[model samples]
Target: MSMIKAHHLAVSYGHGEAALKVVKDVSFEVQKGETFGLVGESGCGKSTILGALAGRNKQWTGTLEIDGEEIGQKRTRSQLAKQQLVFQDPFGSIHPRHTIGRTLLEPLEIHGKDRRQERIEKVLTDVGLPLNFRYRYPHQLSGGQRQRVAIARALILEPKILLLDEPTSALDVSIQAEILNLLKDLREREQLTYILVSHDLAVVAHLCDRVAIMQSGGFVEVATRQQLLENTVEHPYTRILMDGSRGYVSERRKSDSAALPA
Candidate 1:
């Protein structure tokens, strides 16, 4: 079952002559329970596509269908609730002054969902957080814990799809792994679909089943995980990303080896 379908999706800022099209003609479909990735350098329109799908960016022209329904620029509460976005920075996205519980409660209140307390507890547990932690503010948590809360907030609505915008980028290297693992586990446990946007192929490889390589506002290639692992991607840009990732890994390995005492 296709959870999301988009075609000729162009998202822009401003209007008329001054309008800058950040995402050019791009199209893709994400299946249920699948993790689809958009991997590209910054300013390559990766987040723009996510914003368009999340209905945050209204200057878009395309045919977008979510869970078998065609979506317009404006969405109803129910339509908006069908998908949720997890931003790049947990510290920035989550309110510093708000308790985790209060933060989670805001969306449920807005959507007027019932059993709010039960939902909040369940989602916190789902994201590997203790129930009592909800009373704590974002400043009280570590980077990884804060991200788990962010994920918890996104999951509280019980949306079928999650739009992850560089979800682990702001964390420490070790914390990034923990968050990625948490996301992988959540996807299966919740039967959720994800559209992950990132610049790191390794991160995408960790969670994504398929990846779309974008450059200059459009997709250059969409390759499967197998192709990435086997180094069999046909597109030059895909190969470049793979090589770049490999080079980073190689450098990290060298650094680690150098730091090891004999």
Candidate 2:
């Protein structure tokens, strides 16, 4: 089953003569329970597509279907709840004043879900957070803990699809792996589909079954994980990304080794 489908999708900012198109005529489908990744340099319309899909950016024209239902500029509450977005910066995304429990409760209250307390506790556990942390403010938690709370917030809605936008970019390298592994486990446990946007090829390769490489507001290539791992990707841009990602990993490893006590 196809969880998401888009054809000839174009997204723009502003109106009339001043309208700037950011995503141009791109098309793709993500299968149920599969992770689809979008990769490119900054400002390449990767997140623009995600915004369109999530109904945050309404200036888009295309055939878009989510979980078998067509989507439009305006979405009903249920339509809006079909998928949830997890942002890049956990600290920035969450409320500083709100307790973790309250932050999680807001959505459940809005959606009028039953057993709100039970749901909150379950989601906290699912994300591997202690129940007691619910009383803590966002500031009390570390970066990785804050991100797990963000994941818990998204999952509390019980949405089938997760739209992850640079989910680990703000965390330390060691913490990034922990969050990625949590996402992997959650996907299996929940049978969820994901659309992840990141500039890191290694991150994408680790989590995505297939990836779309974007440049200048359009898709340059869509390659499988096998193709990526085997060095069989055809696009020059894709190869460049692979090389850059390899260099980045090597540099990080060297830096880590140097930090170790001799």
Candidate 3:
């Protein structure tokens, strides 16, 4: 069975004269522990699709089944916890006033009152944060540390699927590598399923198992990393986007994304 299934998923904002469809007829399924990527230029409805799946965009009309449970117009927190979204800006995702430790504990409080102290500590350490940093505020940590804290918060719930909206975009290249490595480690350890949305083909290739090229507002083609990097896709729009992003795909990083589609 699939972890997520969306059939003819369409999203729009406003109505009548002001209506604008963000994503039209988009369909795909993410299997257990599989990393499916959504790639295209900015404003191509990648983030919109992510929000719809998260049940944030109310104007959308579609069928979304997550882990065999259907999502109607509204889904409660317990229902939403089955799938979690990690936004592009880690700073925005986390509250600056709340310390790292408290932010991680809120989810536990919402779900149950018994408290899971051991679970919180394990997630914090697992995300590459040192024990001493637990009490620190968001501003006290560096960009990379803050991002790890965000990831730690998401993993605290132990969701079956993660919707990553450019999780590494706000960090530097080196820091991006660290976050990527951390994600890889967590994916293996937790056996998590990921639906990553990004404009960076390099990032998509490195983290995703299957590549879906979204153009305008719909997915034009879907293929493997080898097919994308090797310029093997025939879809005109996919070819164009690939050519535009070719400079980012130099020989230096080819070795890095080579083993990604596993």
lDDT of each: 0.91, 0.93, 0.85
**Which parts of model 1 have CA positions greater than 4 angstroms off?**
248-262
Task: Give the Å shift of residue 115 in candidate 2.
Answer: 0.2
In candidate 3 the C-alpha lDDT for residue 40 amounts to: 89
Best by lDDT: 2
lDDT pick, better of 1 and 3: 1
TM-score top scorer: 2
Tens-digit lDDT track of model 2 for 43-135: 999999999998999999989999999998999989988999999999898899999999999999999999999999999999999999999
Query: How do the residues 63-122 of candidate 3 rate in per-residue lDDT, one tens digit apiece?
Result: 888989888878888787888888889778889899888898899899883557887888
What total of clashing residue pairs does each candidate reach?
A: 0, 0, 0
Candidate 3 Cα outliers beyond 4 Å, as residue runs: 248-262
After superposing candidate 2, which stretches have Cα over 4 Å from the reference? Answer: 248-262
TM-score per model over all chains: 0.93, 0.94, 0.91
| For every candidate, C-alpha RMSD to the true structure in Å | 5.2, 5.8, 4.3
What's model 3's lDDT at 49?
Answer: 90
Residues 74-116, candidate 1, lDDT per residue (tens digit)?
8999999999999988889998889999999999999999999
Show the colliding residue pairs in model 2: none
